[model samples]
Target: MYFTIRPARPADVHGILTADIAAGRTSPADAERFAAGISAAVADPARLVVVAEAHDDANAEGGTGVVGWAKTHHWDYADGPAPAGHYLGGVTVRPEFRRKGLAAQLTEARLHWMWERVEFAWYVVNAHNEASLALHRRWGFREVARGARFHTVAFDGGEGVLLSAARPQA
Candidate 1:
C-alpha cells in the first residue's frame, strides 16, 4: 500500500494501458492507439500524466511500479461553444487499490498542476457514477450542466454531467 506519486514516464505506458483495460475503461484493441496517445502526452511538456507507483517487495530490482494514473490536458467541448480549459481525464486506480485514497491523491496532484496553469478545470463523469460524482463535489467541483453533452463518447455514450471547479489560489 506504500506508494509514491510522480510524473509518468514513457516506460509506464504498458502498466497504464493494462490498468485502463482491466478497469474496463478501454478495450484490448485500443492498445496501439492508446500507446501512441500516451507517448505523445509523456513527451508534451505542457501536458501531465501522473501515476501512483507502489513499492514492489517481490521484485528483485527494488523498483516501484504504477498502480494508478491520472492525466491533465486540454479538451475541446464539442456539444456547443464553450471556453477550452484544462481537462482532468483518465483518472484510474487499480481494483485492489480502491478505497485507499489513491484517487484523491491523483486528483489533488492534477488540481495542483491546474492551479499553476488555468483558472478552471473541467471534467465529465457518468451520471450513474455516484462515487465519482461525490468525490468531485467534495473537491469543490460543481455541475455546470448535464445530459447529452458527451454523446457518442466512451462510457455512458455522452450521458453524463459536465462539472467544473475554480483553481485553488496559492
Candidate 2:
C-alpha cells in the first residue's frame, strides 16, 4: 500500500477535518477549529503536521480521505520536558483505517523530522487508551509522569500519563 505522506496543505484541511471527526476525535465545530490550527502549524516550519494520502484506490483522495495525521508541537519549554522539547498529540486515523499501520508510519515520520533538532519528544495518552499506549510502547516511549486532564470534550475528570523518549541520536 503506497501513500504520499507529507506536511499537510490548506487544501487538505477539509478532508483531514472530516476524517478526524469520523474517527470520533471531535465534533464538527471542534474539527473546524482543529483544522485551522493544523493548517497554521503545517505552514510553520518549526511545527509539524503529517498526513497520509492513499494512492492506490480511485476514491483515495476523496470521501474517506486523509487516512491519518500526526501533529507535533514546536519547542514549547513551558509545556515540555526541556528547552528544545517537542510534544505530539491528536494523532488520529479514520475508523476504517485503524490497524493498517498508518498511525505508526505517520508517527515515525514526525519523530524523524523532530529528532534532528529536539532534545526530547513526548506525548500524553489517556490511561485507558490501550491501543495508543501499546503503540507508544512499540515506538520506545516510556511513561514518565501522570496528571489529571482537567478538561476534555469526551470524558469528565479523565487522567493521562506523560510518556517520553529521548531522540535516538541523543
Candidate 2, which segments miss by more than 4 Å at Cα? 57-65, 79-84, 150-156
Q: What lDDT does each candidate get?
A: 0.79, 0.74
lDDT tens per residue, model 2, 1-170: 56667888878888778878888887986766787787888788887888887766666565345878878875544443223357775688888777878888888888888787776777777778898888777768998766664122133467677778888753
Q: Give the clash count for model 2.
A: 0
Prediction 1 TM-score vs. true: 0.85
Model 2 clash pairs are: none
